[model samples]
Target chain A: MIVIDSPPLENCLGFLALSSYVMTLAPSISRIVFPKYKKAFLPKILLKNRRLIGVFAFLFAFFHGWLLINKRHIDFSDFRTSWIYCQGIATMIIFTVLAATSNDWSVKALKKNWKQLHRLTYLAMFLLTWHVWDKMSGHWTYVTPISMVAILSTTALYFLRLWYEHRAEN
Target chain B: MKSQRSKKRAISLGALMNFIVAIAVFGVGRVVWQGVGLRLSATGLESSHNLPLSAEAVPSIPASHTLDNQGTWIYTVALSPEGSILVSGGYDGQIKWWDRKTGSLLRTIQGHADAIESLAISANGQILVTGSWDNRIKVWDLKTGNLRRTLRHGDDVKAIALSANGKLVASGGTNNKLQIWSLETGQLLHRLPADTWIQSVAFHPGSQTVAYGSQSGQIQVWQLSQSEKPRLLQTLVGHQGMVGAVAFSPDGQTLASGSADKTIKLWNVDQGQLLKGLAGHIAPIRSVAFSPDGQTLATGSQDTNVNLWNVQTGYILGRLNEHRQAVWTVAFSPDGQELASGSSDATIKLAAVHDLAREAIANSPLAHTVPSERESDSQDL
Candidate 1:
């Protein structure tokens, strides 16, 4: 009954959009659900398991790209130069950081800097959501409800994590 | 008294010479063969007998190839029966494939809840099996890249291998057992028992026998055709560290085992005798593979190099030092024309076995890096 004019074709795009939203919340969920045992708890050689979660997230992002960059079977050539593509380009960049640091060597090589670089994943999550919204124009109606909920939920987790870290530092 | 001292000095000199010879031979081996003569590797080994590039090898053009992206830490690799596919498993619990030619990412088959420690592709190229830390073996359909089934296990699965016909698959891990499955019916046909925690498994050619190595430094052979009860056919004991990998020669007369003690041993299967001990790698050796023809051996190591050895002489033919990080997995193309390796560096590489014949690699995996810029825009954090 809440179908306030959202197109049927847009729902499929919503599929990719939904996948992204689900992925964007992974870190926040992992923190709240299994706080004591985030990826750092796995064996050293197996630490890539944690980073692998990021790989799948990025892959879902790519599938999102394929759908947007590809309309029908026309290919990347046929798509309009939408802001969504730029946002996609942005999301891929953040994912690349998460993916690159997936290795122990990358962790060790980058040292303290690696953790900071990975923190960029926070910026990327919202940018990617915005990118998805940009596809829907002013009314990506189907996605907007969930997006608003997720953005607020993730923002709450973010601030809570920040305050906790700051209090611990004190 | 003078004579005794002179004899002692002579004996010491002989010992020194023997040590030097062993080190020299271990470092590299030059085997002169019929065709596809080797182009010498920079590490000073002559691999004249590797598959001619025209046969199973193809020159790499990196820009055209989108190398596999599986886990951030790769542990194992295997070539599909057709050699057109390369499967790599990583510490990230993901198994990914790439086109053998262009190295483009063909598919990412996901299911394992933990790191995938090993992989095996069925000989007919129909199924790709993986053993994971999640305590299971997953059988995947090659063409569709879908997770077909998950064979539950009791502990971490360290190694996996498939038979030549694509009918049987084997997995070895935590409980010191080799679990064999029938791909056709999705039945786990048998579980090969072990004397200790088994580390690796390899199927002998043309038979139901499987050769496995263990943390106890013992390599046991289990014949599946006759009985479910594994026989203590041979205990290939020599290495001081754990036996990491084992392979049966194409002819089935010999078996090769590599260990963490930094030595590779060839055992006479029928005789159960240690034929020769190959030592050269500076660190633990991870996996060993025999080329299709059985004349050459490919080995990956913690030393970050893949060494090709002459099976007959136990001599190092040449060293492939391209992975930059530890080269945990290696496989030969079905036709024996190419060689592929997966490294901890998060990339899979294909080298034309024949390209070595040209005397110098025009370009290697070391020279190229993935598009690092791909990360800049995508982060949601």
Candidate 2:
């Protein structure tokens, strides 16, 4: 009825991007959240491959966007309608910068600034939450609610940890 | 000691933030991958189109024929009154006609410049009207496959319905404008405005009434007379999501509305009361139709299933899972013996609904299938 007709390939690529992006950040998060399991095999392997995983995530996201634009014949001239997708566009921009700078020379040249720039991943992730929610609220598939819950819970945990740490320090 | 504790807190907070981001990404990733993977095998061709035609059957409900390799999702399908000819249209802007009995492609019309969104055929089977994304509604002579007229719309024409009398064609689209036109002269007789885009339209069997479902989850029924303006009969609003399809029962006393909210509701036409709600689809419903006898309702959905429902009790009589992708449209043959479903997998599947009905009747004593009708009424369109 409401045909949002994206091919399976497009969806798969999007999923891959999400998965890799999560994996890229999962190790450190797990280390802090569950300190006892910080040395776990999965976390160690993920950490070792974190840079490659981040690059792969960016690649998948790039293809996903490209495919949608090409297949849908999206008209960029209609800024009024296109403005609704600003969050997704902004996230992609951050991913592009991260992907471009995922090299030794750029990291050395920028030094401490590189760390600051890479922190943009958090902002990108926050923006993506809004993007997915905005686009898929009414048109939810099985994965939509689960993704929302996991994202929300993890975000909540961050604030909880922040509050607890702040109270202990005081 | 305080500085050390602050640094440790920063480290943990950064890690926790990363974890939160990761969790969100992972959740979305799995949804796109595993969720869609269950419905579609996305590795190679991403569709079962490559499966040998011999293996197309699904246990009880057998696919009669598959119009193969359609290139993209077939958005809409219509069956002739007598049910011998099958017409389908989709993203490629081509209208394909198939012989119902032989399962052969009869003719392909390069109809529009954009994807065809909706299709309707006159009860007499003489006229075929197509609504397209190119902002045009084109009428074709069903017999000769020749274009008769092209009626322009303000925007993408999403829905169209032809009156049973073959004189009036009602169309609505993204412009939030529902326009009624003279089928013969291509003159716009009336234009009505809605709060949002109209996704589906249906004309009452009596030809004096018209109903349309909108993106805002509202269904409006109107009374139309040639001498006077169309009067609003009722505004039915219960669906939580967009109403994708609406069809009037054969008797015109009941209206069946299907919505993206994944539920099919039966409404009392005159009273505008919700009669019954049928919910079996796990995904959004795209199309709905009532059998000629008004005993059965067929609904197609993004869940890749076409469910046949018993209209009286609001129970699922049967389900056809022959489609590997989202079914965009479903239509019952005038005789009510066959069902043709068009899907995003680029295939049109013809199923034996009569047999499905019989099987359901065997399971539920209260259920009934359609009886045979006059043969002359099925003359090839």
Candidate 3:
């Protein structure tokens, strides 16, 4: 696999901005991604293709955290940076919990209680998004548009599903 | 005190008899309620769901039944168009065909190296299709019980569907691709964008329109255009879990979908609207279909019950509670007179839906007689 070249640390101001944008957008994107299936074509078996795709998404986010650790240049002891670290840790914990339990074995072993644990994915998305966006105050131009689109599209999908369901029940 | 106890016992016995009579009458009445609803509105509940008590309840009974091969876990069952045969795909990769009447083994077809997960039958009734964990769709010539063709993909085939005319066969797999094939010469037709492994596919009768539901809780309509690629006509999304099964009514006007979300939903294909939510399955609903006359729908669920519903009103007409395990498949006969359900309980049951017109006509003259009531009144006089 090819790794893209790292740009200059001076222009890396955009990196922090992009990181915040990705973080802020995760909750909205996740809202669209995970849900109780109304008409899931595939019955749940071990490593169902849908579950595998979900695993891939989680893997991509894991790589995102590694990139953040390498990019953030913080002083050894800053109170402000401690908040960001806490958020990062919380996001990592949520993602790890989701990724670990997203398997056929876990689903069957946990049974009726599996859904409760799986619901943590949404909360993780919320923490990850807030952590990144709060750090970028001056960089509204680049982060705002992307995050706005992500948030709006997710909300649209949710509401559209709600409207369609309402018409059916009545 | 003895007189009061005797009176209480008498009242309880009367109530119990009424309940028993209700079940007994419906068990017979539903199987043969032929001309009963014809006097009512065409779309019975579209006008109003306030149906008479007679239409609300049905006594459940066993028709001709078939037994399935059991595994540590039995997966699913599929019925043929004619309803003469029953098929069960098991966790052991074994597929067995049974005589719908006698529950005897007709034949067993083989091709999958792993468990056979999904099976579909062509509308023409000549071909039987199976999708397995080994990632292949094997089409079997039902008469010969011989494997005719094997369509291979990269991932495990999860769900399979055959069009109403049986001219087209579609399969969705782990690869997240929905491929439609021409059954005539075994040619590749169109590879549509299915965003996820499709859980179910249904076709509209008069048109080249197809509706598929995704694991992502999305159902979209795709029309085969005059152009090279088919166009996405509409997206119907709402369910929270995986959409497990879909069926088009005989006329193709309505589409029914069952889900892991534990609801069976009816959709209006023309306007792309959700029409009804047939609820009550405790576990995930595995499969759903309309009766041949489109008067009723049968839904199978992991809850181990096969529910027969009045389609227009959503009232559960009958419940088959025989299966000790999950109910996997439900099918209606082409003539609309019978229903069959297959389950993990290792059994398949056939239910008859005969005409009620005969019963009403035969009993009307007897009801017109007033001599019996007059005899009782004369004694009192």
Candidate 4:
């Protein structure tokens, strides 16, 4: 009867998380690796919407968490009982905090700590990787390609930013 | 003024690019998740927490006689009425019969050109009916493993059901036609056109009535009395997705239909009214069967779980998650002690339902507080 269930929504949440991760990474790449290329249209666009993208990612993560809690009927008491459940709940918590503090007011209030707090996105990314891998283990045919792309792109961007920063310092 | 306008334009362009990048990334991730989910459902890997007891933990439902090495998805399984032989047919297009006790292959009968989707064993266990994707229905002598006769259809045969007396075989398929045939003579007795592809069929126990569930989510019951042509009795409508499997309670009072909607609906057969909807599985339900005594109902789902429900109360008694892939069919042995489940993973699992249910009761805290009548009744059975 065309019932809207959890699986499709879960996929959507995964997509939103991925998009958020990429969006958050985009501005850093533009600022560090391609500082001279600031005029580039893609970099400028990503820099402008970085906060919005992060907020969206967090929203998606929240919805994902809500859906899972409702569908699985998970008891919060068992949060420490299962490793998979713990990892997922921890990731959601991180996303919730990041989303709550994504505004300019939090940036002004937390000052330098804001930057460090937002760095938890990297941790969230790592946990999400492990979560997806653990859940979709045998179905590598479907998961591997997208994961490789995300991982390789992030890694390549990180290295490029490091190289550019080193060159500027020298 | 020109420089200020240029700067503003650049900012807008950058915002647009961010939006585009976000959309692209989201799209890729969504596609990947969807693909994985579909593949998991197709292979029956979708996981559910409903089954706390893994296959190994439950010693009662031992991996008795894995008829493996066939190397293809087993779509349908049936145990002989006598419970001496187990027969499974699948994408391999070969029906393999095994000695139920020894777990040894007794015979492999081949005739269908394509995958066999549905199978039914007559009450006497003398005749075996199989509907195949090859658009053919073949009746075989269960004892000899010989094809008695082949009935051709206009499209792939999706489901088949044998009458209690084994005299009539009802089949429905992708052709949107339901045909009743004499198993002995292979003569097509009646052909009824349906609104959509028929995915599952069930014959009412000890009656001339037959039920067929369709892709359009409608369940039709027909009374095929010999005196009159087959008459449409009632249409049970509730399921939102394709009805994958339907089974009649042993007593013939209730009919259970499992659907891709991930719910099992029990209907009062005589009144043709929906009784209760049993919802637990996270994915599509592929098969459903009532225990021999009609007290418990077993449902196999694309979520890779075989869930046992108390038919009277619609409460989940326990879940069997032995299969790694979607469980396509579940059949209780004639005596109702053993529950047989076939999966897309190409393995047939024989579960001791009685023992598993007992263990569930012992493990559950509600054992003392809540008196589950169905659990006790199953134990008595």
Q: Top TM-score: which candidate number?
A: 2
lDDT of 2 by residue, B1-381 (tens): 999997686556545545544554564455445445535532223565542211223233568888874456688999988888999998778898899898899999889767788998898889999998766799999999899998878667889999879899999987788899999899999898888879899999986899999988999999899999999999999999888899999999999999978888889999999888877666678899988888788999876788787676554656678787778899988888898899877788888888655644453435433422210111110
Please, what are the lDDT tens digits per residue for candidate 1 over residues B1-381? Answer: 999997686556545544443443332222112111211221225542322211112222222233646337677787777777777888667777777877777777565766687888776677878887666788888878877887766666888878877778888875667888877777877886787767788988888778888877888887776355556577676778778888888888888888877678888888888877776566567888887777777788765677776554444445666665666777778887777877766777776665332222222224432322211111111
Docking class of 4: incorrect
Please give the fraction of native interface contacts (Cα pairs under 8 Å between A and B) kept by each candidate. Answer: 0.00, 0.00, 0.00, 0.00
Rank the models by lDDT, top first.
2, 4, 1, 3
Q: Which stretches of candidate 4 lie over 4 Å from their true place?
A: A1-170, B1-35, B38-62, B356-381
Question: After best superposition, candidate 4 residue B281: deviation in angstroms?
Answer: 0.7
lDDT values for all models: 0.63, 0.76, 0.61, 0.74
Residue lDDT tens for model 4, A36-147 = 8877888788877777777677667656665544332222322122443566767766766676666655677899999999888777766776666554342233334575
lDDT tens string, model 3, B277-330? 766565567778777667677888766677776565455556676665566677
DockQ of each: 0.01, 0.03, 0.01, 0.02
- lDDT tens digits, residues A77-144, model 2? 22322465687678777876786666555578899999999989878767767876875543344455
Best by lDDT: 2
Error of 2 at B141 (Å): 1.3
Ranking by TM-score: 2, 4, 1, 3
Question: For every candidate structure, what is the RMSD over all alpha carbons to the true structure, in angstroms?
Answer: 21.4, 15.7, 24.4, 12.8
